[model samples]
Every structure is written in structure tokens, then in C-alpha cells.
Target: MRTKLATAVGAAALIVVGIGGAQQASAAPKAAPQAGLSGSKTWGNTVGWATCSGTGTFRVKAICKWEGDKHTSWVTLRGGSAKLVPPACRFKIERIGVHQSV
Candidate 1:
């Protein structure tokens, strides 16, 4: 008799735990979208082949290097697309990064 009572209580406890787990899983929040750095490359005398995507404001930054000179280049992006144009001197991209803005 005692063994049957213990088994019934254990089964009831398992049902209650399973219901709580199901409710918590259904109520969980989804993740929000975020921006990211896509890629960078040289094209002719410009650095226009850079790409970025996803949500929020972002900036694509690059160092344009030519001979003995290098300068900072960047482009502001919103949600979808943007472009980066360095100084119009025969140059190549030496380094790159992404920055989130307000």
C-alpha cells in the first residue's frame, strides 16, 4: 500500500515539473538582430567593396595605405548597406574594423 502511494506522489510531482518547464519554454524571449562587419577588398583606386549587414547603426573603418602614407577611412551605415571611400591616391587597405555608433 505504501509503495503504491509513493509511486503516485512521484508521478504527480513529475507532471507538475513538466507543466512548469513547458510554460517557461513557451514564454522565453527571442534574440534581437545585430549588425556585423562583412568584408573588405580593393577595387581600382578606391575601397568601395566593403560590406556590412543586419540591424542598428554601424561604421566600417579602414586604413588606406599608399607608399609611406596611411590614413583613416570610414563610412556610416544604417541597417542594410554602406560604402567606404579612402583618399584618391593609389592605395590598398592595410587594416579594417567595425564600430557601433549612437
Candidate 2:
């Protein structure tokens, strides 16, 4: 009887620990950086390319929107220019936005 009680208590404790771990993971922020979009432009046809520029001391976040899809990511700028490569070919770039966090 005592052994069964101990086993049940241990199992309950493990369940609580597992739930805590899951909650922590869900609370963690996404890998994407938080920033603001300043300006951006796209070029090319077959293999499209893009450049995003912004004013911020930290890294910049670029959100690219295509036909019916959207991609959010971070880019490091050199000389105020950050290059972006689309995920697919012939995907019309509808909009590109930049973000910077303070």
C-alpha cells in the first residue's frame, strides 16, 4: 500500500514537472528578432533578390510578403544594405517591410 502510494506521488510530481517545462517553452519568445521596417526594394525575375535598409543600432527585421505567403526574418546590414533571397522562384514580392527594436 505504501509502495503504491509512493509510486503515485512520484508520477504526479513528474507530471507537474513536465507541465512546467512545456509552459516555459511556450512562454519563450520566438527566434525572430523584433525590429521595425524602414525601407526595402526587390529586383530580379527568375531568382529574385531583395534589399532592406533601416536606421537602428541593433539588428534589423525584414518581413517579406509574396502573392499569398509571408516570411519574417532578421538580416545584418552592411553599408545600410541588407540582401534578401526569396524562398521560391517566380514568387512575386508584393511588399517588404523593415523593423528595428530599441
| Candidate with best TM-score | 2
Q: Which stretches in model 1 have alpha-carbon errors above 4 Å?
A: 1-49, 66-78, 88-92
Residue 91, model 1, lDDT: 60
Model 1, span 1-102: residue lDDT tens: 999999999999999999998898566332112334354444444343345554445444445565433323434444565554434435665554444544
Clash totals, every prediction: 0, 7
**What is the C-alpha RMSD, rounded to one decimal, of candidate 1?**
18.0
Stretches of model 2 off by over 4 angstroms after superposition? 33-102
Range of the 10 consecutive residues with the lowest summed lDDT in candidate 1: 28-37
Question: Model 1: clashing residue pairs?
Answer: none
Per-residue lDDT for 68 in model 2? Answer: 40
